[model samples]
Target: MALAIFDLDNTLLGGDSDHLWGEFIVEQRIVDPAVYKERNDAFFNDYLAGRLDIQIYLSFCLQPLAEHSAEQLVAWHAQFMREKIEPIMLPAARELIRKHRDAGDTLMIITATNRFITAPIARAFGIDILLATECEKADGRYTGHSTDIPCFRDGKVTRLDRWMLENSQSLDDSWFYSDSINDLPLLSLVDHPVAVDPDDKLRAHAEANGWQVLSLR
Candidate 1:
């Protein structure tokens, strides 16, 4: 069976989960609303401009996990899922996933967002295999630091190569769907690269490369 890999943010969902999580925490007063939001917005803009420093962004994003108890964080996440994520869930995305499932393809999601925020969303999508940026934990508490290379840009290729080796999977006849130009490294490796609701840069690249481009929204 072929492997069907999907990008979590803007590709499958109607919005960016990592950025939305930042907004959610600000609304919850879990962070300094004004200052935190300003930084969050700047980071998101950097991401869109393809110039984000994933390390610094991860540090800023994961600090809240360090400050709060795991229990509290879980509770907040449940609320965040209901309030922020549910509304943006795309029916078209689900249909596409099901189409691959019916074809007996192995489904996976690879996202730059941390596991804390994306794990449940992957489960909700019925995708068992997920490769996401990992948040380091110590003594059952978050350490506010990432454990490995951030699953972003070329790092996605690095992470996927390791996963494929360990799992005995190959990119032969594999399909990858993404919305951002940041995923170009991984997208180029796949047999079928789909640009779903792509941003301007990715759209331009997809058109120039003759990759299939469509909207999920």
Candidate 2:
């Protein structure tokens, strides 16, 4: 079976979902503006530079989930989806996903963003399988910690390999669409690699490798 995997942030949307999620929380007054806003900006910048420390970043991002009940998060996320995520949906990205889906490919969104932030976004795109950074829970609340290696950089390949093993799938007939140099491991692993609005390094690598480069935006 053909497997089609997509990176969620800049690849599928017009912007970064994780950064937008931080902005949404700050705008909603869910986090302390005095503290979180600056940190959020720094983290986003770090991510763009491909220097994000996932553990430290997740500690900040997931803390809000831990402070609120699941019900509250669900309601707040519904609002977040309406106010932020929906507007950034790229039409071409949706069409590409649809094309793959219509071809009976096993479709998935694999993102470094946490599940709490990305699951709904994946659903909005009509994708059922999302491999994202796992948030640990305890006593029906978030622990503000990741339970497994984040689905990021080389870790994306690790998570994808485990998923393939569990589902009896293989990358031999897979296609991966991504925008970051960080995803090089999985991009190299897949039979068909597409760089969608890729970063400078990734674009250079894609060109060097003769991979298809596209712009969803």
> How many clashes (backbone N, Cα, C below 3 Å) per candidate?
0, 0
State which candidate has the highest TM-score. Answer: 1
Q: Candidate 2: lDDT of 17?
A: 85
lDDT of 1 by residue, 181-211 (tens): 9999999999999999998999999999999
Q: Give per-residue lDDT, candidate 2, residue 105.
A: 96
User: What is the C-alpha local distance difference test score of candidate 1?
Assistant: 0.95
Question: Which lDDT value does model 1 have at 43?
Answer: 100
Q: For this target, which candidate reaches the highest lDDT against the unseen true structure? A: 1
lDDT, model 2, position 202: 95
* lDDT score, candidate 2: 0.92
**Candidate 2: deviation at residue 83, Å?**
0.6
